[model samples]
Target chain A: MSLQEVFRNCAEQRRSALIGYLPAGFPTVSESVGLFEAMVRGDGHTPGCDIVEVGLPYSDPVMDGSTIQSAAERALRNGFRVRQLFDVVSAVAASGAVPVVMSYWNPIHRYGPDAFARDLRAAGGAGLITPDLVPEEAGEWMEASEEHRLDRIFLVAPSSTEHRLALTASAGTGFLYAASVMGVTGARESVSDSARELVRRTRAHTELPIGVGLGVRTAEHAAEVASFADGVIVGSAFVTRAEREGQDGVCAFAGELGRGVRTASPEPAGG
Target chain B: MTARDLGGAADPDELGSPDSGSHDPDEGGHFGPYGGRFMPEALIAAQDELAAEYDKARRDPEFVAELDRLLRDYAGRPSPLTEAERFSAHAGGARVLLKREDLNHTGSHKINNVLGQALLVKRMGKRRVIAETGAGQHGVATATACALLDLDCVIYMGATDTRRQALNVARMRLLGAEVRPVSTGSATLKDAINEALRDWVTNVADTHYLLGTAAGAHPFPLLVRNLHRVIGTEARQQVLERTGGLPDAVLACVGGGSNAIGIFHGFIDDPGVRLIGAEAGGHGLDSGEHGAALTSGSPGTLHGARSYLLQDEDGQIAEAYSISAGLDYPGVGPEHAWLADSGRAEYRAVTDEEAMEAFRLLSRTEGIIPAVESAHALAAALRVGTELGPEAVLVVNVSGRGDKDMDTAAHYFGLVPEAGITGEDQQ
Candidate 1:
C-alpha cells in the first residue's frame, strides 16, 4: 500500500501511524531485513509498524546520532551497497508494509537520481525521506520523483520560518517530516515544546500528514507525540536496541511503541 | 529480500555528462560535480545568509580596503619570495624560490582566511566564532583573529591531535579561546569537522562557523581562496622580477588544498605554469594508509561537498594516515578534484619518509624549518627539479613554520635526549 493509504487508515481509526527505521545491511543484509520484518509484524491486535523507513547508509551521516552512525559504519564495513537498499525495500513491500528510503542526497546523486527513482519504484519503495536535502535545492530530485511517481518527503525543522514551511509543504509528498528538536538524531530527555507549534504552523500550509522524528525514544514519548502528530517516527532508539539485543529486541520494543500510538489519549482538538 | 536481476536499466552513465570547466562554482555552490551545500535543513538559512553577505563583502570597497589594510599591517602581507640557493644543490641545480607564508603572523598561511572570516563575523553581528583544527595551526590562527576582534572563540580538535600538538592547544587556550577535544570517528581532522558542523547547526544563530580551509560547502572554498589569493599575487610578481618570467612549475602541499589553490590562482590563467599539488602518501599508496585522494580515491561526497575521497566500495569514508597531522585528511577540496579532472593541474603523493628528509634538508641547507605539511611539497619539488634540470625555475609555497611540529619532529628524529643524560655529555 502507498504511504498515503497507511496514514489514511490510521487517521480513520483515530490513531497515529507507527513508523520504524533501520539501515539496510546493518549488522548484516539478511539480519537487517529480518529485523525490519519483525517490526512490521505487529502483536496481531495493533500493527507493529504502519510504515518502514529503510536507511541507505552514507559515509558521513552528519544528521545521525552515535547509535545510527555506528550501525551505518557496521553496514558499510559489511560491504552494503545501493542494491542492498532495493533488496530490503522489496522484502518489506512483499511483507505488505510500505517501504520508504531514508538517505542523504549524495548517494542518490552519485547513483543518478532518475535511475535511483526508477529502480526504487520497481523495488516497491513508496517514497524517499531526504534528511539533508531541502526543497530549495531538490529540483533534480523533484523531477526524478515525479517521473517515477514516488513520494518526495522533506524535513521541516522547528527552526523553519513560515516561508520555508510553505515551501517544504508544497515540495513534499507522502508526509512532511517534523524534526522535533534542533539537534542531530538521538533519544533525548525531553521532547522540545516547540514541536507542537511547528506542527500547528505546518498545518496552516498543507493538509499532508506531519510525522515527528528526532529524539522520540520511549513508548511514553511516542504516545505524547502521537497525541498530535499524524505519525510517530522512531529511528536511533530502535537501532540502539538492535545493537544491544538483535532482532528480538527490536520486535519487542516496536510492539510496545506500536501500542503506545494506538492507545494514546488524544489531546482535546484545537488545543 | 531476494536479489533482483542485475539489469542494464541502472546505467551509471545515465547520471549524465561531467560538469563543464567553470572557474567559479555555480549558483548552487557546485564546482563541476564536486562542491555543494550538502547539509541538514536547519542551516539552510544560515548558509544562504553567509553566501549573500560574502557576495556583498567581496564587492564593497570599504570592506575590501579594510581587509587589505589588515592583511598588510596586521597579518604582514607581501611575504617575501626567498631563493633557496643552498637547498638547490640537492635539486639537480634548479633555481627554487619559496613563497614565505611561514613568515606571516601566527606562523602559517591560515592567518589570511581567519582574518577575513573573523571580519565577516563582526560584520554579521555574530558575537561568537567556532572552528575546527587538525595540526592546531588553523585553531591558533582563529584564536588570534578572535582575540584581535574581541569575539568569543571555541575550537574543536581531535583528542589525538590535542595530545600530539599539546603546545598548540595551550597556545589557543592562552589566547582566550576554549579548546574542546573531539573523541569520535577516528578522532582526527574529519571528526573534528563533524563536531564543529554539529555545533554550527545547533548554535547557528549566535555563532559563525569560521571554516579554516578552502573546502566545505559553498562560499567557503571561494571565500578562503580569495582571502589567500595574495599569496599567489605577490609570489607571481616577485618571481617575475627575480627570474624575468613565470616559472616552469608551481608546487604546494594539499591538505584541504588552501595554500596550493591560493598560489595556483596566480598562475592558473598562465597555462604554461604546471600546477602540481603534493598529497600525503603516508607509507605509500599501495600501503592502504595514505591521504592521496586524487591519486587513489573515487568521486564521493563528505563533509559538505563532493570531492575525491578515500572511501570503501560502500561509500563509507576510510581513515587516512600521515606523519603530518595537517595532511592526514581523507578528502580534497572540490576545486582540486575539478582541476585534476580538467587537466589544469597535476597531483602527486609524497611519502612520509620523503617529506621528513626534505624537512631536515631544508633546515640544515637553507636555515628554514618548514612545517611537515609544506615538506610534502618540498619533497615533490626535489623530483620535479631533477626532471626539469638546471635551467628550470620553480616556486614552492612554504605554507607554515615548523614550531608547531617541533614535538613530532623531535620524536621522529630522536632529537630529545634520555632523561639521565648530562648537558655536557650531550653536547
Candidate 2:
C-alpha cells in the first residue's frame, strides 16, 4: 500500500497510524526479517504498524542516539550489505506493513539514486526516508523518486522557518516528518509541547500527512503525539526494547502504541 | 595583512563536476558535484544563518576591519616565511621556504580560522561555542579564542585522543573550556565530530559549532578556507618579495585539508605554480591502514559534505589510520577533491615512518620540531624536491609546531628511557 492509503485508512478508523522502525540486518540479516514481520502482526489481532521503516545501517549515525547507533553498528559489523535491505523490504511488504527504507544520503548516492529507486520500486517498497538529506541537496533524488513513482519523505524540525517548511512540504511526496524537538533520535519520557505547536504550524504549509518522531517513547507519548499528528513514528523505543527483550518485546510495545493511537483524545482546538 | 583572502553523490555520475561555476561551490555551495549541506533538518537553519551571515560579513568593512585587527594584533599575523636551507640539503639542494604558521600565537595555523569564526559567533549573537578535535590543536585554538572572546566553550574529543593528547586536554581546561570525551564509534575524530553535531542539534539556538577543518557542510569548507587564506596570500607575497617570483611548487599536509586549502588559494589562480597535498599513509595504502582519502578512497559523503572518503563498498565510512592524531580522518575536504579531479592539485600519501623521519630530520637539521601532520608535507617535499632537482623553489606550509606531539615522538624515537614509557602507552 502507498503511504497516502495508510494515512487515509488510519483517518477512516479515527486514529493515528502507528509506524515502527528497525534497522535492516540488526542482530543478523535473516533474524531482522522475522523481527519486522513481528512488528507488522503485533499481538496477533490489531495491526502493530501501518508502515515499517527499514533502517539502512550507516557507520556514522550522527542523528541517532546510543540505542539506534549501537544497533546500526552491530548490523554493519555483521556484514550487512545494501542488497540485504531489498530482502528486508520485500519481507516486510509480504508480512503486511508498507515498507520504507530510512537511510543516510551517502549510501543511496553511492548506489546510484535512479538504480536504487528502480530496485526499491521493484521490491514492493513504498519509498525512502532520508534523515540527512534536505530538499536543497536532493535534486537528483527529486528527479529519481519522481521517475520511479516512490514516496520521498523529508524531515522538518521545530527550528524550520516558514520558508523552509514550504520548501520541504513542496519537495516531499508521501509525508512530512516532523522532528518533535531540537535533538537527535531517542526515546524521551514526555513528548514536548513544541511538537504540537510544530505540527500545527506545519499544517499551514502542506496538505500532506505529517508524522511526529524523535522522543515518542511510551504509549502515553504516542497518544499525545497522535492527538496532533497523522502518524506516531516510534524508532528508538522499539530498538531499545528489542535490545533487551528481542522481537516479542518490540511486538508487545507496538501493540500498546497501536492501541494508544486509537484511544487518544483529540487535542483541544487551537492547541 | 588581513586574512580576508583566500578565496556527492548522486547519480553514480550526475553529481560534482570539475568545472561547475565561478564561485567554486557557487551560491548553494557545490564544488563540481562535491560539497553541499548534508546535515539534519534541525541544523539547516543554523547552517543557512551561518552562510548568510558569512556572506554579509565578508563584505562588511566593520567585520573585515575587526577581523584584520584581531589577526594582526591578537593572533600575530604576517607570520614570517623562513628559508629552510639546512633542511633542504636532504632534498637534493632545493630552495625550500617555510610559511611559519607554527610561529603563530597558538603555535599553529588553526588560530587563523578559530579567531575568525569566534568573531562570527560573536557577531551572530551566540554566546556558547562548541568544537571537535583530534590532536587538540584546533581544540586549543578554539578554547583560546573563546577565552579571549569571553564566550562559553565546550570541546568534544575522542576518548582515545583525550588520553593520547592529555596535556592539550589540561591546556583546554586551564583555558576555561569544558572537554567532553566521546567514547562512541571508534572513539576517534569522526566520532567527536558526530557528538559535536549532536550537541549543536540539541542547543543550536545559543550555540555556534566552530568546525575546525575545511571539510563538513557548505559554509564551513568555504568559511574556514577563507579565514585561512591569509597563509597563502602572505606566503605568495613574501616569496615574491624574497625570491622575485612564485615557487615551482607548494606543499601542505591534508587532514580535512584546511591548512592546505588555505595556502593553496593564494596560488590557485597562478597556473604556473603546482599545489600538492600529502595525506597520511599509516601502515601504507596497501595495508588498508591509511588516511589517504584522495589517494585510495572513492567519492562519498561523510560529516555533512560529499568528498573523497575512505568508505566500504556499501558507503560505510571506514576508519582512517595515521600516527599523527590530527591527520587521522577518513575524508578530505570537497575542494581538495575538486582540485584532484580537475588536476589543479595532486595528492600523495606519506607513511608514518616517512613522516617520523622527516619530523626528526627537520628538528635536527633546522631546530624546528614540526608537527607530525606538517611532517607529512615535509616528507612529500623531500621526494618532490628531489624530482624537481637543484634549482626548484618550493614553499612548504609548516602548519603547526610539534610541542603537542612530543610524547608520541619520544616514544617513536625512543627519546625517553624504556621504563619511562611503554609501547602500550603509545598505542
Candidate 3:
C-alpha cells in the first residue's frame, strides 16, 4: 500500500508505524541486503522490520553520529555507489516493505538530479529523506519525486517557524517527519514533552501523517509519542539493538515496538 | 558546478587544452596515457570549472598582485637563500644553498599554495573553503587562508589522526575552522580526502575544495604546483645574486611531489643543474615499507589523476606505509611519474632510520630540526656530498620547519619517555 494509505489508516487508528534507519552497505557490501531484509521482513531466518531508511554514505556526512559513519565507511569499502544504493532499494521493494533513501543533497547533486530521480523510480523507492535539503529549495526535488511517484518526506522540528512549517507541509507528501529532539541524530536516553506538542502542532499544519522520531525510546516514550504522530521513526536504538541483540535482538525490538505503537492510547487524555 | 566537468565524459579533451598539463595538445594530458582526467561521470563538471577558472586566474594581473601582496606582507616572502657552510664544509669545501621555505609564516612551504588558492577563492565568489588534512599542517595552512579571507571553513581529518595529532586539531579550531574527525576506514588522511571530496561534491556551488598538495584530481596538481613554483622562482633569482651562477644540483623530497616539482620546474631544462627527488623508504624498500612511489610503484590512476602507485599483484593500489603522514599516500603526483620515466629527475628513497639519522644529524650539526619529509632531502644531499668528494655544490629546498615534528620525534627518540595514550593506557 502507499505510505499515504498506511498513514491515513494510522491516523484513524490513532497509532504509529515503525521506520528504522540503517546505513546502506553497512557491515559489508554483501551483507547489507540480508541485514536490511531481516529488519523489514522476518524470513524465519531474519527479523521483520517496518519502514526502512537506507543511507547513501557520503565522503563527509557532517551531521551524522559515529554508528552511521562507520556503517557508511564499511559500505563504501564494500563497493557501494550511488547507483548501487538504488539496486538495494529494488531488491527490498520486490519483497514488500517500502524503502526510503536517507541522504544529503551533495550525493544527490553529485549524482545529478535527473539520474537520481530515474534511479530512485526504477528501484521502486517509496520515498526520500534529505535532512540538509531545506523546504525553500525543496520544490524541484518534490516535483521530480512526485513525477516518479516517490514520497519526498520533509522534516518538521520545534525550531521550524510557522511560515516554514506550513510551506514544508504543503511541499511534502506521504509523511511529515517530526523530530522529537533539537539536535543531530544519535542514541539519546529521552526526549522533552515539548516534542509531543510539536507533533500536535505539526498535525494542525497538514493533513499528512506525521512520524515523531529522534531520541524517542522505551515503550512509554513510543506509546506517548504514538498518541500524536502517525508514526515513530526510531533509528539509533534499532542500530543499537542490532548491535546488542544482533539479528535476534533487532527482530524482537521491531516486533515489540510495532506492537507497542498499535496498543498505545492515541488520546492526549493521559494529561 | 556539476560532475560533468570532472570527467568531461564525452569530449574529455575539451576539459583542458592538453597544454594545461605539461603534455602536448595531441597527447590530451597523456604522459604516455598514464596521466589524464580518468574519472567517473560524476566528477567532470567540478574539474572543468576549476580548469577554466584556474586558467584565467593564473594570468590575471590582480590575482598575481594579490598573491605577491600576501607573500610579502602576510607570509614574509623573499625568504633568504642561506648558505649552509657548516653542513657543507666536509663535503669538499663547496657551499650548499638552502631555500628557506621553512621560514614561511605557517612554518612550511604550504602557505604559498594556500595563499594563492585563497585569493582565487575570493575572486571566484566562493564563501567557504573545505580541505582534508593528514598531518595538521595543511589544515592549519588552509584554515589560516580562510580566516585571513573571512570565509567559513571546515577541515575533515581521519578519526585516527585526531588522536595521533591532537595539536593540529586544536590549532585548526583556533583558526576558526571546524575540525571534523572522520570515522571512515582506518581514519587517516586518505579517508579525510574521501570525506573532503564528498563535501566538495555536495557543496560545489559555493565552496572551494582547497587541496593541500599537487595531487588528486585534475587542476589541483597543476594549480598547486604553479602556485608553489614561486618558491623555486624566488630562490633561483636570489641564488643567482649570491653565487653569480646556477648551482650544480637541486634536490627536494617528493611525496605528492609538489615541493620537488615546484623547485624542479624552475630548472627543468637547465643542463647545468641536476634534479633529484628523495622519497621515503619508511623502514626499507626490501621490507615493503615506504612512500617512494616513483621508485617502487607502477603507473596507475589514483585520486582522479594517473600516477605511479604502490600496487599489489592484482593491480589494486596497495596501502602505503610511511612513518611520515605527509608521505603515506599510495600514489605520486602525475608529473613526478612522468619525470621519473623520462629520466629527467633521478628518484631515490631514504629509509626511516636513515631519515631520522639525518634529522638528528641536521639538528645537532646545523641547529635545524627538519620535518621528516624535509629530512629526506637533506639525507639525499649528504649522499650527493659523499659522491662529489666535497667539490660539487647543491641547493636543497628546506620545504618546512621542524617545530611540528618535535613531539613525534621526541616520542620516537624516547626524549619524553612517557608511556601514554595507547594500548592499556587511558587519559
Candidate 4:
C-alpha cells in the first residue's frame, strides 16, 4: 500500500497513523524480524503500526541518540549486511503493513541508489527516510527515487528557513518528516513546543502528510503529537523497550501508542 | 551518492571570474564533487549561518585586520623558515628548508586556526566553544584561544589519546578547558569528532563547534583552510628571498591534511612546483593498520563531508591506526581528495619506523625535537630528496614541537632511564 493510502486510512478513522522504527539487524537478523512482526501485529483490534521504518545500521550514526546508536552498534557487530534488509522487509511486508527504510545516505550510495531503490521496491517497501541527506545533496537520489516510484521522505527542522522549508517540502515525494525538536533521535519525556509550530509552518508549503518524530516516547507524547501531525513516529522508545523487555513488551507498547493516536481529537482539517 | 560529474579542476577563466583565485570552493562548498554538507537538517541553519558569516567576514577588511593583528601579536605570525643544513646531509645533499610552525605560540600550527575560529565564535555571540582533537595539540591550542578570548571551552578527545598525550591534557586543563575523553568507536580521532558533532547538535544555541582541521562539513574545510593560508603565503615569499626562487617541492604530514593543505595553497598557482602529503602508515599499508586515507581508501562520506575514507566494502568506517596520535584518522579532507584525484598533489604513506627515524635524526642533527606527526613529512622528504638528488631544494612544514610527545618518544626509543640517575652518573 502507498503512504498516501496509509494516511488516508488513518484519516478516515479520525486518527493519526502510527509509524514504528527498528534497525534491521538488532541482536540478530531472525530475532529482529520477529520483533518487527510483533510491532505490526498490534492489539488485534487496531493496527499496531501503519508503517515500519527498517533502519539500516550504519557505522557512524551521528544523528542517533544513545538508545538507537547502541542498537545500531549491536546490529553491526552481529554482522548485519545490506542484503539482510531485503530479508527483513520481505518478512515485514507479509504482515500487512507498509514498510519504509530509514538509512544514512552512504550505505545506499555505496550500494548504488538505483539498485537499492529497485531492490527495496521489489521487497514490497513503501519508501525511504534519509536523516542526513538534505535536498541540495540529493540530485542522484531524487532521480533514482523517481525511477523506482519510491516515496522519498525528507525532513524539516525547527531551525529551517522559510525558503528551505518550501524547497525541502516540494522535493519530498512521500511525506514531510518534522523533527519535533532541535536534537537527535531519542525518547523524551515530552514532545517539544516547537513541533506544532514547525508542522503548522510546513502546512503552508505542501499538502503532503506530515509526520512528527524525534523526542517522542509514551502514549501521552504520541497523543500530543497526533493532535496536529498527520502521522506520529516512535523509534528509540521501542528499541529501548525491546532491549529491556522482550517482544511482548513491544507489542503492549505498540498497542498503547496505537490507541493513543485515537484518544486525542485532531484539529479540524483546515485548522 | 553517485559521484557527481564535476569535471576536472576548474580553470579560473573557465569559472568566468579571472580575479577569483583557485583556492576557493564553489558557492555550495563543493571542492569538485568531494565536499558538500552531508549533515542533519537540524544543523542546516547553523551551517548556513556560519557560511554566511565567514563569507561576509572574509570580505570585510576590518575583520581581516583584526585577525591579522591577533596572528601577529598573539600567535607570532611570519614563523621563520630555517635552513636545515645539518639534517640535509642525510637527505641526499638536498637543501631542506623547514617552515618553523613549531615556534608559534602553543607549539604548533593549530594556533592559527584556533585563534581565528575563537574570534569567529565571539563575533557570532556564542559564549561556549567545543572542539575535537586527536593528539591534544588542537585541544591545547583551542583551550589557549578560549582562555585568551574569555570564552567557555570544552574539548572532546579520544580516551586513548588522553592517556598517551597526558601532558597536553594537563595543559588544556590549566588553560581552563574541560577535556571529555570519548570512549566510543575505536576511541580515537574519528570517535572524538563524532562526540564533538553530537555536542554541537545539542547545544548549537550557544556553542560553536571549533573544528580542529581542514576536514568536516561545509564552511569548516573552507574556513580552516583560509585561516591557515598565512603559512603558505609566508613560506612562499621566504623561500624566494632565501634561495632566489621557489623550492622544488613542498611537503607536510597529512592527518586531515590541514598543514599540508595550508602550505600547499601558497604554491598551488606555481605549476612548476610539486606538493607532497605524507600520511601515517602505522604498521604498514599491507598490514591494514594505517591512517593513509588518500593513499589506500575510496570515496565515502564521514564526519560531515564526502572524502576519501578508510571504510570497509560495506561502507563502515574502519578504525585508523598511527604511532603519532595526531596523524591517526579514518578520512582525509575533501580538498585533498580533489587535489589527489586531479593529479595536482601526491600522497605517500610513511611508516612508523621511518617517521621515528626522522624524528630522531632531526633531534640529533639540528637540536630540534619535531612532533611525531611532522616527522612523517620529514620521512617523505628523505625519500623525495633522494629522488630529486643534490640540486633539489625542499621545504617541509614542522607543524608542531615535540614537548607533548616526549613520553611517547621516550617509550618508542627506549630513552627512559632508571628513576634516580644523576647527571654526573651519566657522564
Model 3 error, position A251 (Å): 14
Per-residue alpha-carbon lDDT of model 4 for B32-84, expressed as tens digits? Answer: 88989899888889998998877666655566677778888888887999999
Per-residue CA lDDT of model 1 for A104-199, tens digit only, reads 976887788899999999999999999888775687899999999999999998778888899999999999999887778888887888788788
Screening candidate 4 with a backbone cut-off below 3 angstroms (N, C-alpha, C), the clashing residue pairs are: none
User: Tens digits of per-residue lDDT for model 2 on B140-239?
Assistant: 9999999999999999999999999999999999999999999988899999999999999999999999999999998899889878888998999999
* Docking class of predicted structure 2: high
Candidate 2 ranges with C-alpha deviation above 4 Å:
A267-271, B3-24, B419-427
Backbone clash count for every predicted candidate, in the order shown: 1, 5, 18, 0
Per-residue lDDT tens digits of candidate 3, residues B1-427? Answer: 1112112223243235545543322232445444565442224445666777876765555666667778889999867888888878644556788888888898888998898888878878889899988777899999999999899999999887788778888999999999999776557777787677656654666888898888776677777777777777776787788888888889998888888878887676577888999998998898897877888987655666667877654243466777777777778888788778888889999888777777877787688877788888988888887777666778899888878787777766756548343442212
Fnat, model by model in order, equals 0.44, 0.85, 0.02, 0.67
Worst 10 residues of 4 chain A by lDDT: A262-271
What docking tier does model 3 reach? incorrect
DockQ of each: 0.42, 0.83, 0.04, 0.73
Deviation in angstroms for B337 in model 2? 0.7
> Candidate 3: DockQ?
0.04
Name the candidate that leads on lDDT.
2
Error of 1 at B67 (Å): 2.5
- Under CAPRI classification, how is model 1 graded? acceptable
Score candidate 1 by lDDT: 0.87
Better of 2 and 3 by lDDT: 2
Residue A121, model 4: lDDT of 94
Residue-level error in angstroms, candidate 1, position A67: 2.8
lDDT of 3 at B122: 86
* Model 1 alpha-carbon miss at residue B42, Å: 1.4
